[model samples]
Target: MTTVVSTGSYDYLTSALTTMPTPVTTSSTWPQVPRWLTLRQSLRMARDPVGNLNKVLAAYGDTVHLYLGGVKPSIVTRDPALVQHILQKNHRRYHKSDLTHGLLRYLGKGLLTNEGADWLRQRRLIQPGFHRQRLAGLTRLMRAAADEWVAELAALGAAQGPVEVEAHAAMTRVAFRIVARSVFGDSLSDEELMQLSDWLTAIQLFYVTTIRQPYLRPVQHLRGRYRQHDDLARRLRELVRAAIARHRTAQAAAPADAAPPDDLLQMLLDARYEDTGEPMTEHQLIDELNILLVAGHETSANALAWAFFLLARHPEVQDRLAEEINRELPNGQEVEFAGLPRLSYALQVVQEAMRLYPPAWIIDRVATEDDEFQGVAIPKGSVFSLYVYGVHHHAGLWPDAEAFRPERFAADAQPALPTYGYLPFGGGPRLCVGSHFALTELQLVLIQTLRRYRVLPTAETPPGMNPLVTLRPAGELRLRFEQR
Candidate 1:
């Protein structure tokens, strides 16, 4: 049997790794759940990891050591302070594990995978792409994308009363459109957009499957599954390359005085390094485009899907949101980036929805050198799963953690949030560069959709958690759209 040394409030953990239920000792300071126990609970954990981990943490304390997949030794923590230390304050001591770098095999070395001074350089170079004025310029593209989806809903529900739609599929299309349009402008066609979405989905699905079931590597290699996915990734790169080529050709063909399109691709092409006074090489630019497309698309889609799901379930919330949105963007005015602050309730709802179901559910980091935080010892090469989902849901961090209360994020809300309690966007120096663009895009989508249709809950039960590369609903999420 695996013995739990302690279990108590995370606050006291500053004094020790954690307080135990049984007698504590120097050797047992960091208690490990027996491999056998981890293996025994493997099937259950696979089905409901969030719930299963919650049970283990409740018994073992905020942090515990265990074998991931009954094989690899690692520590999982729901402690906000620990998460903050790894991602921010003491981040230099930690780097992403192969678990994240593995994406480089398929996606290439972009900002998400780059490390050290190079990653810092790239961050500084790319930071300005999302500056306030830049995002304000992109709002038109976002609103256009959102309006198209809303128009589609109106068309669908116009003929049929309360048209039934799959929220995940719908949101996925809209999110992809928004990102694709923002990145490439009119460079890609609808068919190409669809193809890109399919390819990215396939690549991500295969990558996560391999990561989760490491034992399948040999079999996958022999079966040529890896080869097949690599081919898909190659084709994806080619499509992006073609877009770049087209942009270059057009830029060359345009009049010398004419301005190029105001989009992410243009921003990347124009950006020059501070020290070198040179733009990124074509290969580096392509890698970033790939990363941005994937990062910007899937995460936003999942978040949007969850937001609509919550709104459908909580009609009262939708009503309040409608009232607020109406009061702010009255007369059907579109969501301009500058006016986002006025839609405070919409922002709160988005914040709360992410708190309940964060897209980046878990983040993996490894200690680059031996380090210690509080009283816990972290040796070099130690693997840590900063369970962002767990941190968001930890009762000690959020009162009534399981409840859907958007007011918790209100301007004058009581009991302010803990340092790292919320991580809808992974925090620290790497806090998503597109955070402003994403928040603006999400609020726009919500407001536009609400203006056109009332997202009503269906008879279907709640969707199960499908924690893959990102947190997604296990299966299709169906909802009804009653045109308002």
Candidate 2:
């Protein structure tokens, strides 16, 4: 089916395939943007961020000191060296800036917001849940959820006309279903799952709005908007808390011969702290679940939505990928975990899709101690915006960077990929623990969707970027899905 084109270094998790061409200019002195200019362009920057940022980085050097939202003093950089230095090389000298910590007020101190020794402890405790073995156990759940989505398409195709669907909305449902099943594992009702998804979406939209439009805070507070989301957060906790109690009750009441559930929530319950050998407290477990639902759902949903959009436009690529699926899994054979490695082209599609439109477009960090880069002055409280989107699209780094060519990621492509140029998951010890889980699920959904239908493009204008907490399609990304 999928031939290995002379495997070199196939590990995209660590490094990219092709070498970067021109690195953005590096100046001896800091190339900084004026506060007055940044101020004038703040709203425009928010509205047309990917475009505006492209112009800014092209004019200045790779790393530039600019005001975040034209107010907060910060450094925005698309330099891979600076990114590696901050996130990995001299990581001890830094911590996540208060910009990240600010979420703790609403989301609780989960892995996404937690830091220091506590964060490490949490990571260690939860890492086991996403190990190869545990993920294998979860694969069946992912496939089942994908099947449910395809059944929806089956219904649409049966209607006689072209099977047009909004990809973003469709993938959102699929991602949410997989996450819901993986987390609760049949413990939650359909209504409860829908409610949970709604709450996460509403809270994230509210949080992004507050960060983007700081001046609207007083008006929002007067209208009790914050209070409304807080109430939603509280209700979310109650729902999770109830589910946990129900799980414990079910586990306790089950016959000893019956095996326990193999979902993420069970792993959290059974996980004991390394040093203390104690399970996570109820409150902490709930916090972790909330973060899990958000991370597992949002990024994968956006990535899949964009992937289908690309497939619709690139029929040759799609046909080749479908051929791989059909050959390896001839005559409707279901996908197994072991079978995934054979479908290499699908993974490349996912990788390039993410490269073009990374969900976590930017990462924020702050100096815990004074730091220097390439002779720049050491500052104690400097803030940095690691512009991942800028780095991925830098013309200097990628040949025809604007084009979507999955072959660029082929294992045996030309020169090797630059070390720091293709980081989708944030680097260092703080790298996302669920990276493998996300990738496996992404491949599963991609392979399954393409096997049964052909995604065709529509005449509607293409969707623009909605760079929120996650990069999403500005509106519904509609496409025609013809049953094959």
Q: All candidates: CA RMSD in angstroms?
A: 4.8, 4.1
lDDT of 2 by residue, 190-224 (tens): 89999999998999889888988899999999999
Query: What are the TM-scores, per candidate, against the unseen true structure?
Result: 0.94, 0.94
- Deviation (Å) of 445 in candidate 1: 0.5
lDDT, candidates in the order shown: 0.85, 0.84
- Score candidate 1 by lDDT: 0.85
| Stretch of 10 with least lDDT, candidate 2 | 1-10
lDDT of 1 at 434: 81
- Displacement of residue 466 (Cα, Å) in model 1 is 0.8
